[model samples]
Target chain A: MTNANPHRLFRGGAAPAALPARGGIGLKPEHYQYILDTRPAIGFFEVHAENYMVAGGPFHHYLERIRADTPLSIHGVGLSIGGDGPLDEAHLDRLAVLLARYRPESFSEHLAWSSHGGAFFNDLLPAPYNAGTLARVCAHIDRVQERLGRSMLLENPATYVEFEASTMAETDFISEVVGRTGCGLLLDVNNLYVSCINHHRDARAYLRALPLAAVGEIHLAGHAREVDAAGAPMLIDSHDAPVAREVWDLYAYAISLTGPQPTLIERDNDIPEFPVLAAEARQAEIVMARHAKLEAAA
Target chain B: MSAAFARALLQPDAPCPAGLKTWNGSDPAKRFAVYRNNVVVSLVDALADSFPVVQALVGEEFFRALAAEFARANPPRSPVLAWYGDGFADFVENFPPAAGLPYLADVARLEWLRVEAWHAADAKPLPLAEMAARLADEAALPALRLALHPSLRLLRSAHPVVSLWAAHQAEDVSAALGATDFADAEAALVVRDGLDVDILRIEPGAAEFVESLLRGAALGEAAQTAAPFDLPATLGLLLRSGTIIEATPSGRIS
Candidate 1:
């Protein structure tokens, strides 16, 4: 198959027309008309790859219209990349089809596993960070990159539990995966904050441990606060509300380390009007701009 | 190990899989419970989205409970949540909690059909001019085979499921709630035209005619099989709704 855009190379050699290091919002069906009519000054639009897997429909109709004006990032939630069993060849084929059709500026999947034993749990579940699991994950990533003929980013997962069999920190596991597969990292700062708070780890230290050079994109979203059984604060990566103050702080810190990267504001549940999300994307843009200016001056 | 962990997470009462721990070095049971809650609740929400009328009729609390049970017993085998509830209507049919309401299963079936039609493949309907020309050739009209649109689905239920479904779509369903007669048998035809999935009630015999056509029966054979139904009106409905994709002489077109 021929690359639709000859000038754009997603994986090998030099890259052109990459997603600019600007802010974007996750595309929702509710805001399709608004985004098209108002033509908001955002960086790009991201959508779940699974949502557009249909043969033909309104989803594709709107996506075609929206993609004409703005860049798009395809974030997949159902690849089951970290599952123990073999990767689902059928799902990979579907993803390949979508990626080829859109030739999205960026494509990413989560680090967690969501399927096993032929059953797919809708939620991302935690996996042990051991030699065996690491090898399996790396192999999965290799297969995905080979099949798509493009390098993809893997985002760290927000977890509520840890496994006793884990032999490495989550950051180290991710860094090693990147090292072996040559895949980029799509760091979700909100997930880092939620995982750190839930696991009683230092968020700043965790950020410091990540391989910032491999960071190709960042995600900022909202989380819900709840109490654990021991009466400790637990943060749920529920993208239903606006970005939290603490997550914003972490995002700024991450921007300083990684310079400007393609950032996205994800609000999947209880979605407000388009403006509310636009405002959040604007905040991310402001942060990236400040870092850009500082780098230019230095 | 991943498979075992998945089994534990899906089953709420199952013990935490071996070799799991919390960050504080305590038992991972409580923390794992959170993951468990997320999996079950997310799947349940998926079901509720696909079957809104069933949830509305069953009430939120009861629906959540029912969905949770369904999730635990039959977690999705695929990641695509849109296709996750293929067996839900059957599950409800045998569920003891919902035994008091026999129509609940039919409602679920109708909702599932709507979901299927909404995502079904798109097809361009046969042009009216072409159809008219074909009809003018009376010699081959009876042997002409009609191909239905990919989104067409016919459902037959012993209860007034069509009324129940329509009532739930209304702004205020109080009158519909009172007018529904549970004993009446109903048939529904769901088709996706453009971006909309429309549900229309049809006579039982008309449903049979469409089903026969779907099974590759010729026009004359299908009409004969439908027997007492108004074949002309049924054919008109099919044409008007754009459900017929193609018409070809039986032997000429496979």
Candidate 2:
């Protein structure tokens, strides 16, 4: 029988697979063949939406082969959801094309702005948590959701500097965004740790304060440490090494609260062999399993 | 405020944007510097990745400097970084820092063309046999319009950029560069067929022929423009490379 609800068919019927609440690794071009050949057992695979914004090439070819076997997540780095300028309709259109082509299980973007005026800076810059900035961000998110016809997860930014103009707290800002836009949150535990350390906030408190019920996914990555002028350790979200021990602790804590969201280990720079990333993914799974056992006992 | 921050982050000498405050209420200059550093360094790295041979030719330090200057003057307009550096070749041509290396700009241009060819739209090649069958009728040949693959790119430079680029790819770059004759003008035909991007050095006239074909000229007309060139060899190369996407006859075929 034909389903009466076409939206349900579009959302679930066309989706290749659902993201299991376990762990996945960020799919890099370097490890495309390794993943295809081995087809490791993981929850899902995540890719930066911008990387696959092409007509056709090995990127799409390998992604098609991988998507057939595993669930996919399209994480956008260029949406600039928090930008002051209007969202690039052309960029949004390209992203829509990719989303339709892949029909990924989940889509996510950052709360930080990466583009200003007409220039895309390529790095996620911080935004003030004020009413003006909040209104602009909400409108942008609305445009994206309406255009893509899919709910997206907005990630928190790892800030090196906070704006004095921010009248609202970071957690409140994110909560308000979720409250208003109906979008989920991609809680990057590493970014939380980095921002807390850089800005002297309590990571544990920040995690507990966030709207945990809205978290659809989790991200874990490594960070580099450097000192500021006053010799305070400043954590940079480098994503070039293994997930830091502190960030892992926060991930475990977050999972204990949120109860095992889909986690992704992102290693963009200094990418190691496939086995290395797979092992990290396994560690995340182990943490989630421990939490699951605890929850069942309770 | 976001505009000010972007300007400061892009330009090293620009003052820190207003409204920045650190955790301890100290001046946020150092903290803001980190974001600035990340933006400039990452964009420079992107350029390096896009133009590895250019980086190899002009050492890491010089390339980083050049890229930083380019980033400040001309930041990317699109988020697709693969499409970034569209104006890098022009930037290099006028960059005073690269005044000594005149061929550097053309090398950069060749590299940019390679990048474009790599990301160009994919096309299905018309079978050579089918194309040959269609072209069998000599009377309709002049009216036939041949379409090249979207990825096909022809480059011409007064300097031997093709050889220089090839040299940088060799293991002993210094030796390869030393052996190359910089005075010889060169042309290159770049096309992505199957799974690889093939860059072949072609005769100047052959490049003109491909250019004409790309402009929707008939085979006979293109051949006339490419006179004194090896037509048979060029045709064989195009066919072997699988670059012809379609051939449409202007007149009805029997």
For this target, which candidate reaches the highest TM-score against the unseen true structure?
Answer: 2
DockQ of each: 0.64, 0.72
Task: Show the lowest summed lDDT stretch of 10 residues, model 1 chain A.
Answer: A1-10
Task: For model 2 chain B, give the 10-residue run with minimal summed lDDT.
Answer: B245-254
Which regions of candidate 2 fall more than 4 Å away from where they truly are? A1-17, B135-140, B251-254
Single out the weakest 10-residue window by summed lDDT for candidate 2 chain A: A8-17
- Mind giving the per-residue lDDT tens digits that candidate 1 earns over A73-130? 9999998888888999999999999998898999999998898787888888888899
lDDT of 1 by residue, B47-79 (tens): 999999999899999999998999988988877
Off by over 4 Å in 1: A1-17, B249-254
- Residue A135 C-alpha lDDT in model 2: 87
> Against the hidden reference, what TM-scores do the models get?
0.94, 0.94
* Candidates' chain B TM-scores in the order shown: 0.94, 0.93
